[model samples]
Target: MERGRDTILLEGLRILDLTYGPSGGYAGRLFAESGAHVTKVVTGDQEISTFKDSRKRMIRTTDNQLPETIAEQLAVGHWDIVLWDSHMALHLESQLASLLEKISGSCLSVRIHFPSTVDVKEEHALQEWGGWTSLTGDPHRSPLYIGGFPATSLVGAHTAAATMFAWLEQKKGFVQVDALTVVVSALEGVYTNYLETGEVRERVGNRHHTLTPMSIFPCQNGFSFIGAPVDEQWELLERWMGRAPNPNWASVDERQQSYPALEHCIADWTQGMEREELFHTGQAFRLPFGDVQTLEDVKRCPHLNMRHFWKGQHPSDGIQLPWIIYRHSSCKLENRSHSLKRLRILDLTSMWSGPYCTRLFADHGAEVIKVEAPHRPDGIRGNSGESPAPFFNELNRNKCGITLDLRQEEERAKFLKLVATSDILIDNFSPRVMENFGLTREVLWAQQPGLIIMSLSAFGQTGPYRDYVGYGPTLESMSGLASLTGYRDGIPWLPGFSISDIGAGIHGTFALLAALYFQRRFGNGLAVDLSQYEAAIQLIGDYIIEETFSPTPLQPVGCTSIAELAIQDQRPLEVKTSDGKRSISTPWIIDNPENQTYEPAPTLGQHNPLLEDYMAKREWHHQL
Candidate 1:
């Protein structure tokens, strides 16, 4: 084993955050939070207000001139990453790809922008988020820009995930994340549905196409909502309301067909009760329920205080904000490099959630073995018609792919053998799929006591919706995000991105990392039950908490930005945070996983011998 190595996850990650807006700042903040040495560079006369987005985490600032030799200077500094904001600087500088190529260094240059086409005149104008969101929402209703600004945070988070992956492999290239591309990627199925089913998902007002009883209803004092996507939850809510359960609304399709009536039934019960009484009573039976919350209620939420989420004060107003959104209870710093080269993960996930989570691991230097079925491989790979799709390549990069017919008895046994040698196993199948394959938690624990199995599902392993079907829209609706997303009094609009699935992946990554650390430290097993719906609800958790106490039901306020939404009807605050601290990151070390590169996905059954050999070794070691 290596000795005396010292670092955090991103200890030597020196980043030049030259972005001018929230997206770039959000990306920088992610790296900074992960222990990167981030320098928010001020080039030309860029306004100071740009720093307000991430002022709390930023530790360094530099006054610099972007000369003709700007690329050369960046290379000379040996910065590990340069997160450049391409949208705001497009007019002032050369095209991003060219500038990045001219720079000679191993540093990863990330370009954040709005999606564009080849028409130069048209492309630059379409970079604003308002233009993009205009294409979304009800065609009848005006194109809504929620809060009237770009959704930079969504792109920024994805950029951070990609950059960390690149950094782990010593890869040098320009990574581009446009607002348009990220949003579409988030809502991948929208295009796929159009391609396969010839149906466009319309802007349905405050309800999912399938899930019944998922809308904001008027309460005694205000409006509230419930998302009983499953039969049991609906039944439970019916019992709680002292009414006969609608036997016809047992299935999602059935519920959709009679959504108006189902909604009316829920509204009838919720409208009479006090919002607080309903909130506490419904939760007692574990109903997927909540009320709408005002910003004032969000500010004073006790749940947020219990979580330590709103620990950080805003740079301008000293108002509280979330410090840590993804929480893990145990993560200790050992005297070693934060590399996952020694770890082996069995990735049995595909189509965003599971694959994305394992990609985070693979990019962090873990040896990820992605297992696909012989008859049906990853849906993304099958969808790749001709050219290499960035959609597939980006998420499945840095992992070994092998096919296994886990349904077959022989292949299933071989999988169990492989499992005994693996550190972690991850999947996003319906809760029963693993049990059906005889890969239950009890079976896994009996064979490999220390193994960590993360079963990511739409409703988790034990919920009433455990066996229910789901998609990205299912989460958006069921999680109550759709309830508060569109214009007030208008239909609840779905965002361009599959925000829920992406969040689950990111949060799942954090959960697995913590579980792995715990196993290594305490010799214990961890089972991560990641509910996509539950994970997604965290994004709008304050809204739920607020409505639980407040008299008002929060309605969709068409916001261009959170900055606008937070201020409500008041004037926007533009307080300058000029006192950001300064610190330089440590130099990169020699002992690293940079020497290793990702093994490409194997052709079907091509690597069968490798698995057979691994099983043989496992059998020999176990004296079987």
Candidate 2:
């Protein structure tokens, strides 16, 4: 696994990409970017877009030559990974079965499938079938689909991740990733709420289900999200509005009851101010605010520009991608039967982005320590009196939870002790929080120089908006996603859930794995600054590129109609939690014999004793 300094993370890996659409194409692009030698075999006259095809070698073939071409390629050399779409499977099922048998023990093959309900390869119709369309846009209007092929893009990401997992584990198998399951998995709290309470959530325009003032408000020039979901943030908003904190608007429930009046009051205050002014002012008050940015605005975004996020040959094409800033160093890693069995992660993340990122690793046998302060546990755990939320259990499954008030010196010392033996540290706090905690890269590296630190923030760790706070909706609004979502003539609307959070999590997991691969091969430590905003923009990068090149702007269609078909009602695979509550299983379906069984999420501080033992040993020897 040794490589030269000039080699990229996945340089030695060879991938044969036989994907027909953007779903598999995006996955190949990610592999290519990480330095894998990706060869895309095009069986038709499909136009190759620079965004998805730039780093890959292209081979053309007719439909009739597909099987022969694949056999020829497979014979020439061993490919570490092979990717194809389900549509291609219809024609080459027997051919693939024979070919795969020859390479079954050596290569990881991934097939991307649309739901059976989708008779055509239409993304909009797939969205409708997956329930994404039904949950987006205004409740009074027709359901809207998210801009770009987000569902498919997510499928690609998940497919890439699954492939990497198998590769790391040195397993030979076939993996199936479907668009419908990926979409349903990302619905986040929506399905969980329905299952737990039997409450079918409908479109609430731009507002959050429980969080008040988390909606887009019109500014003098454009719209901006004034999200103050937390009580502290809401109080700041009240002070900024030159009003005393009224008792009626004290709690989330109270604010929900007074939604109309509160929204009207905020809208009135914001209507006269420009979006930029409102954004900065609200951020200065420590409120989570964001500008509803268009593609043009996103192109000129100072934070993205400063981070050099818009890369590739044509930087002006507005092709935004993830940027991983690395520092040179070295460490030794032991190979394990399970991909991440030897890996230890300290997850200091709350809500969705960071938790979801670590959860992926946890599911694959990583020792993930979900660290939270006693006073401020992960917000998704729900209020003090209630049981942990279903979304929390789903996202944090198979992870060890321990409360450590980092603010206290004793707890901070224990955490640093754990860091000395850990491989990675991930946090989604505002950029300043790490600095405030005096846990800078230099400080953490002093304990373990080869530690891979990943920070998933709203606007990243640098740039002007580095300190600004934001949630998934804020990032979505700012990432140009919201502007392209909604009816053609209607205002921009957010997706049913915090899609940006989930998207960032998936992207973060991939990026972290890439870094992990590098660490294992070269023993080098890296710092990955993942912005949920940039990650959101990347999901719709093709659309942005299209809009940049096209004469007319891309308009949102509420929902596209398709011929009626017998949509399959295949229930998603589920596993029972420790409480006997059923939850959707992890989206990947890999035919690997060594896959671990599902485990229930840990209760708060459930693994405190485990942490105590690790601290006593000053090493991670005992498995949870």
Candidate 3:
């Protein structure tokens, strides 16, 4: 049977969704959206978001009936995936073992856990415990909650991806996805910075920790984010502002030193123009500038509308729904211990998004080769002279690293040769960077026609803002996340970390898994164009839906009061890197029979000799 682009990737997969809360609901929703037959067993009157229940078939039942419902469903052996939360697991504790036994070999069970002390209903407490509230908002004021139930949504993404990974490996035992771990994992450089420098990361309002000129500024009508981290962007900004570049503000460190003064000058210049005008003019200079948009403004965004990013309104409330747009040419029922052992991935991504995506695969036995340029490696590495930052080491662990200056013809040839032997190629460069390097999708396909190519761009390819540069903050502002995440009286605020980057990375991981499945099943190649902008908007889908039907606009509440409670476990799980540095372990916990081990991130070009040996052998194989 031939599958068209419109065909759902997980079409025939059956999922038994016994989850309550946003986390499990969202996970089940992802499965449902991918065309799985997801039967959600709603046990209580607990409110459910329309976004989470979009494509699922609901089965209303009472707490008493829940056990029987799940038991019956598992007994039939019809479900490929089973999703539930810790609360429900406790509810059916006596029968939980038996119910799980029924699907032990046939189905994959995923449990989303939170601390026993914290109630799932208390969003603020979860945020605080998860280390999110501590890092958001202004340093002096109360820490703010990231708008929408982002922590739960992040857990949902993890749950869905874990289930898919288990399914791909054909391992059907038990998987536990901790909500707090998911939140902590997305903290990016926070923990590492504290570990390395003993300096706890505090709120800096809309400013980034490392990047200068990457903060929000007030315009004539409203505020806009300006992210120009590179020296080239700084030069362009100066030219646009009609000022000669000063030698003092040349490098990143110098600009950081002069942030206050530079910010003042930029603010003065921006104050003369309206928000829209400033956005367009800044974008004209190829700067990553975006107007802080409200939910209403996001609804009317031309790029989102053109892409049909929003599904139809809610059935009962007429509220708009956000949709995940997959470009196509794209899970599972299997359990091999090392499912991806033979697979090789070429990771040409830097910073968080791309590295984070490939890291997931690297942890699960996939051979991932992280490719960076000799001159300019991943930005997260900080200065070339210093050791790779803790965050970089944490994200790039278990992967081999090699340097390739693609600008040089020799390096480009080496990269192409690598692509020929690799199964997947991942990059998060701007849409033009790849094309300019003469490594377009067409060119890559010629090297390995069955290659699964995924390009994670700021705004997607072919969109009006495709060429526009953006970081996490830029996307957050442009996608309406910043607008929804601050105090009512305060201006828009960015999240504690580059959340959009992390979210897009998880989405990319899931998409790549699906693409790999499709390739193995049908022998076809796929090109995935993932837009961080759209992924950011999807994170606030619940808010978008709620505001659509509400009489008044949604307003941000600074922070909710948290109660002191005893958590089940007070100790944080830390793993030792190859360099003896302790970092957080992988987020989720799996209870499979196979044991997995961790490895530290490789040093720059650490595996160049090994890669060269492999490439020589691959070339020899090709000649034969």
Count residue pairs with overlapping backbones in model 2: 0
Best by TM-score: 2
> Per-residue lDDT of 169-239 in model 3, one digit per residue for the tens?
88888888777667777787676555656666666766887789988888888899988888998898898
The TM-score values for the models, in the order shown, are 0.61, 0.92, 0.90
lDDT of each: 0.55, 0.77, 0.74
For candidate 3, the 10 contiguous residues with the lowest summed lDDT are: 559-568
Give lDDT for model 1: 0.55
TM-score head-to-head 2 vs 3, winner: 2
Full ranking by TM-score: 2, 3, 1
- Pairs with steric clashes in candidate 2: none
Q: Give the candidate number with the greatest lDDT.
A: 2
RMSD of each: 12.0, 3.6, 4.4
**Higher-ranked by TM-score: 1 or 2:** 2
Q: Which lDDT tens digits does candidate 1 get at residues 445-488? A: 66666677888877666534456545565566555555555666
Which whole-number lDDT from 0 to 100 does residue 434 have in model 1?
A: 91
- lDDT value, residue 505 of candidate 1: 78
